[model samples]
Target: MNSATDVEIHAIKQVVATVEHAQRYELVEEFVSLFREDAIWTTAAGRLLIGRDAIAAFTWQVLPGAMKDLVPSYEVVHVLFIRPDVAAAKVRQRYFFPDGEPVTEEGGAPRCT
Candidate 1:
């Protein structure tokens, strides 16, 4: 990985660790930390959730309920720069639910909900 990709991947890893192991409140900040101040996050449903504050609020609302599973495993399939200032990636994640439902695959808003 190039330096930029390495940094972004590292940032993602830190957020994942915080989300899985830290309290929900602690994760709110950690999630935002992975995003740029002017980041534009688009939901898979095509909703435009903009900026850090908006993202943080959105994260706080659904994190505890939908993300209490905490421990999740993801593979970064690809990361390509859209421009010098923009980059995007494709990730696949699997969650091992505590309820013993076996491994579940979830992404986008469904995971957030």
Candidate 2:
């Protein structure tokens, strides 16, 4: 791989790592720190959150106790560079119990737009 590609991957991995860490520990502040001040996020259930404040509010409300027995894994399946600093990533994510049983059912996965 070229150095440019390697750099991009490394940068994106940092973002993913932060996300995973926040989710694993349910750290609302740390998770919210990853987003831009003007960023927008939509929940899997279709609620739209605009800006970091909105995202932080929502995250703090639900992250606690939401994954008491579930472990989530996120894989970056594809990454498309739109520009030198902008890219789109396709992620495959799923949840499983600590014992390794998959959580397969409706509402088990989140939809990202």
Candidate 3:
């Protein structure tokens, strides 16, 4: 609602955009760069990855050809600021085929937090 919040939202949107770009192009390094050194990532298949190094390893193994037949998209639907410097974003993820057909279940409009 304030200028600071607006700026943060804009920055978050940019991060979401970058994520979409990286996934669309399967840029392993670019995708991994979004995580902090101590970040933890849980894959959709329930694989738990701890730390940037682990994340990088997993990404390198998967991201390169992950998008060969599909396009991944991320949209930030909500952003909850727990504090001045801490925020949690909710992102809606979808996949589409190269021909623009939805690859995942149909859902409502995409959003991110």
Highest TM-score among the candidates is held by which one? 3
Q: What do the candidate models score in CA lDDT, each in turn?
A: 0.61, 0.81, 0.86
Clash pairs, model 2 backbone:
none
TM-score of 2: 0.88
Give lDDT tens digits, candidate 3, residues 1-113: 99989999999999999988998899989989999999999986678999999999998987887788878878898999999999999998888878988865763322323
Clashes of 3: 11
Candidate 2 residues lying further than 4 Å off, grouped into runs, are 105-113
Q: Lowest lDDT 10-mer window, candidate 2?
A: 104-113
Candidate order by lDDT, decreasing, is 3, 2, 1
Over 1-113, each residue of candidate 1 has an lDDT whose tens digit, in order, gives: 68977887777555555544433344566667777889887754576899988878877775565556644555566667777666676666555556645354453333344
Models sorted by TM-score, best on top: 3, 2, 1
Q: Lowest-lDDT window of 10 residues in candidate 1? A: 102-111
Q: How does each model score on TM-score?
A: 0.58, 0.88, 0.89
